[model samples]
Target: MVADTGKTLHADTLKPVNLPEPIAVDEDSAGGPRVVTLGRKLPVAVIDDVWRIDDEWWRARALSRMYYAVILVNGRRLTIFKDLVDGKWYHQTY
Candidate 1:
């Protein structure tokens, strides 16, 4: 669900959205995802939080990702992630 603060709150029950259009990103010197483009460019104003998930490593396929809760230059907050397994970006909403 989207909060009053304009941040989308994500949950596992939320359906995964595979964007038809790829989002363009700007990275920091450290090569971390720092800016993102949806329909328009959104520079990351602040990273409210970050976390990593590494699961199913024991299996032949692994599920790994780095998630970030970020505020954009336009004052929108979103939850985005980089898939560690394939290095793709995704945005989520609930």
Candidate 2:
């Protein structure tokens, strides 16, 4: 058993992790990502995979996005998504 020390003890608060951030991306005529800009523009060397997610239609803000797993010309790999709702791009970890 622990004794009270006359000071309030608060539990650790929870916080969100890995929230998505907007990024700049250039797409091809076919609407596929051709370049991604982090600090500099990096051409996509290879597009390994692609998928889409559309959920929470009943909510005020629905989630709709097209995801891509790509390798850059500099040999770095990244997961990126295009928000179908806003037509914006973001990079995220898998």
Candidate 3:
């Protein structure tokens, strides 16, 4: 048996998780991240991998990004991306 509850649920009530936030990045001459600022400036040690995603071309707002998986000098791994559409940098977890 269940109790009757008079309540409404809306899509807007939900929230997104791990949403990408804008980050400050210093790039090398070849257009790769050389340094990234989270709380402090962290130098990039090596780029582990790189990839690009160009999807939803038919949509008004296409999704285009250049992603980089890098290891910081402090041995911390991070995943970041450059929004090709907006020319901005963001850090996210895969």
Q: Clashes per prediction?
A: 1, 0, 0
> Candidate 1: lDDT over CA atoms?
0.79
Q: Quote each prediction's TM-score.
A: 0.71, 0.84, 0.87
**Candidate 2 structure, TM-score to reference:** 0.84
lDDT scores in order: 0.79, 0.93, 0.95
lDDT per residue as tens, model 3, 1-94: 9886776778998898999989999999998999999899999999999999999999999999999999999999999999999999999975
lDDT of 2 by residue, 1-94 (tens): 8997887655665566788888899999988899999899999999999999999999999999999999999999999999999999998964
Residue 33 accuracy (lDDT) in model 1: 67
Per-prediction CA RMSD (Å): 9.4, 4.6, 3.2
lDDT against true structure, model 2 = 0.93
By lDDT, the candidates rank as 3, 2, 1
Give residue 30's error in model 2 in angstroms. Answer: 1.3
Query: In model 1, what is the error at residue 21, expressed in angstroms?
Result: 8.9
The runs of at least 3 residues in candidate 2 whose Cα sits more than 4 Å from the true structure, single-residue gaps closed, are 1-12
Measured with C-alpha atoms, the lDDT of residue 1 in candidate 1 is 75
Q: Which stretches of candidate 1 lie over 4 Å from their true place?
A: 1-22
